[model samples]
Target: MITIILICIGVLFNIFGCVGLIRLPDVYNRLQAATKCVTLGCCSILLGVVFHYGLSDAGFKALFAIPILFFSATVAAHALIRGAYHFGTKLGEKSVKDDYKEVVK
Candidate 1:
């Protein structure tokens, strides 16, 4: 029952992540969506896998993957966003506040 619920939640978040990737206007926002939502969704699914298959090799792999996913997702997102900034990807028209502008000044 818990597994089913977790799977559903994961799927929902995955869908939202994909939608955000497609719908967001700028690279930074898309990266934010992908990193936050997809990582969270994938993590939940991996945890469910661990719970469903405890102590076995599959469980161990899932357990290992959780931290790897966390680390890699964060680092990759950071790198991508930084690269986008370096390349001068413009912010969407609706964006408020130029935080980076202030920092760079």
Candidate 2:
């Protein structure tokens, strides 16, 4: 019941992430959106797994993975974007600002 609901919500988030990845204008925006949404989605699914399986091995693994996924996804996204910026990737035409433009150099 609750597990199913959580799983469904997670699935929706994952779908939204995929959509964002496809529709966003630039690499940075797309990666940020996909990372954030997918991280939350995967964490939610892992939580549902914990609820469904309790303290079993699989549940424990899923529980452990939640934090790893959350941190890694965000950190990886930041690193990738920073690297892209440093490598001279241009911002999208519609981007209103570049917070890193002055600070990064």
> Model 2 has how many clashing residue pairs?
0
lDDT of 2 by residue, 18-54 (tens): 9999999999889977898998998899889999999
Please report the candidate that would top TM-score against the real structure.
2
Write candidate 1's Cα lDDT for 1-105 as tens digits: 787788788888999999999999988789989999999999889888888998899999998999999999999999998878778888888899777876543
Model 1: lDDT of residue 13: 97
| Per-residue lDDT value at 60 in model 1 | 98
Structure candidate 1, residue pairs in collision: none
lDDT of each: 0.89, 0.90
